[model samples]
Target: MRDRFTPLLAAWLRLLEPACVRCRLPADSGLCPACVDALRAFPLPAAAADDPAPVRAGLCWSPACAPLLRRYKFHGDLAAGAALARLVLPELRQAARPELLIPVPLHPARLRRRGHDQALELARLWGRELGLPVAAEALRRVFDSRPQTRLSAAQRRRNLQGAFVARAGLPSSIALVDDVLSTGSTVRAAAAALRTAGVDGIQVWVLARAPGRPTARLGSGHEQVLHEHATEQSGTHRLIGFEGTKAVGGMA
Candidate 1:
């Protein structure tokens, strides 16, 4: 009798659910199956040949996925955050696994405003899925820097400098987990801190890689800009271009 009503219960739940965030179609989940397929089908850009840190990402950042991240990161949508983790899991499973997962820490002030740390949330979700332990306290943000979204690459670097400090007794090899990778300033600084704490290996993982362009001259021997080039195809912009990176990686 219970099994007989299971389908009906599921159907009723679907009716009461909200529409898919991306397509505005009725969906039990915030994201529909079709949108998930589209996200999986998006072509990933080639890794930067000169990138020092091994990086893995689930999707390329675009207008299509930006709102999902914004909702999760800024608006405190745990469901949206779970959707993103599901999307990124496959890519992370393919990469080199670390002894532990460490999220880029949030300053106390920002944590108060946000109510939850996005990176910590991602790390916990991933830790449970991947069967790894999360060292949430391994790293701490010593400074409460301004937001990095509107800042240039140089400014981003300056803003995040000395922002992270790692605690002792961290694993020799651990992956730094975050929501997105853009200019990479944040992760580079974080990785540097871990190095200072005597960690030997670091892997960077993120849900998406945002498009960026090198503002500094390529001839200056500075970090080259990695950006996604948009090509209009079939009424949608195809995200194709260089994988964005700096000296390392971070979410902007």
Candidate 2:
């Protein structure tokens, strides 16, 4: 019977799998302990005291974490995506639960080129772990928009104004999943469309959050900085000191 041979099949497959892509270690998990530990060292703050956006991330985006996501996103690497999903599972367990999972939809053109939607891939992984439904086709991108990475927050908002359209009725609450949050324009637009269709509560869940909000103008305030510290310097942005001490004044 297939059940009788399941364990044997698993063992045989493990033997043929490649080493951890990041460390070249013999790991069937797609990542070794060392790389995972390095990622944990930079997990995002559990919760920002004054942040109102219901966004949550496992790690802050960094040069080290970039390759893992880029490989999964651009190079069509499934192993990298699963490893990153495993890293995010713990944080999702610690957060408030949601009724359903919805991935930010991709334009059909982009979807054809990539061959898969990265957000949908991540949503499926998390949904399996949490016993939630993944509504991959519940919302659709109505039109293609410019890449958001280079745009200011305001510009991003404008670009996505009508990018997403709901394909069906939404539930009262759902978690919107994505691989990363930069200016957050895409998620915001998706949420707005969902809300207009009667979904009242929305939670934005992502694997990572890129550092800084869309940059502000010259001589402007340091709103882009996630951390605020009052140190012995005039124009430097430092994270809150260890244990969140090194007291700084004013709000971020």
Candidate 3:
């Protein structure tokens, strides 16, 4: 072996423990202040829903803010998750203000594959920050469905129909937590299940909200595979490969 690459290898090893998640700057936390500021500016306009409860999201999904979610969602990056929570919690604390936080449930299979429910993690983080209680078992994903990418709003709704079931002991008023609110189908289905279970008044508190509709309606069969790949590198997932992200129906 030669010494030609020693300096580069040393520099990479030194940079392994970066100070900032996005900018690679010197900082005490996962994200530096500059990156945080940039992220703050990506909040989308609040959207209205026709469910039993209203839905609110903290940030708009953009290149700057969207990719950060993959780190928290699939790579087991709790610090990244915390940074994302810091962004969404303030909005929910001020807006939804529900005393109970209900993380959207994952299907048992998906839960096993992903190793964690991103929504549950977010709910716990928000609960701690807002001094609220998190009821992660309030709802359940009764069945699994196809990956949500490339589906239309109608198809998304159809895919999740009868998929979620809310349990008893859920509070009368609470907010449902999810990582990304895409088309809103998942939350709607979750909310409907809760309502059917006699729980009243639901709100959606999600971290990122995709800004507009997908460019095309072409159905791609790579949704689940892409998710697995995203988890492998933490930076490879793009607009179509959101892991904890939801789909094409009306979002909360």
Best by the lDDT measure = 1
lDDT value for model 2? 0.68
What residue runs in model 1 are displaced by over 4 Å at the alpha carbon?
1-14, 17-21, 24-30, 49-52, 214-252
- Candidate 2, 154-196: lDDT as tens digits: 8978988988887657788899998877667788899888887
lDDT of 1 by residue, 114-230 (tens): 556779888988999899999999999998887664578789789888999999988898999988777788888999999999998999888887545423322222121122111
Of candidates 2 and 1, the better by TM-score: 1
In terms of TM-score, the best-performing candidate is 3
Model 2: pairs clashing at backbone N, Cα or C within 3 Å? none
Model 2: lDDT of residue 137: 85
Superior by TM-score: candidate 1 or candidate 3:
3
Give the per-residue lDDT of model 3 (tens digit) for 222-247: 23322443344313222121112222
RMSD of every prediction: 11.4, 14.5, 8.0
Residue 167 of model 3, lDDT score: 84
Q: Candidate 1: global Cα-lDDT?
A: 0.71
TM-score of model number 3:
0.76
| Lowest lDDT 10-residue stretch of candidate 3 | 243-252
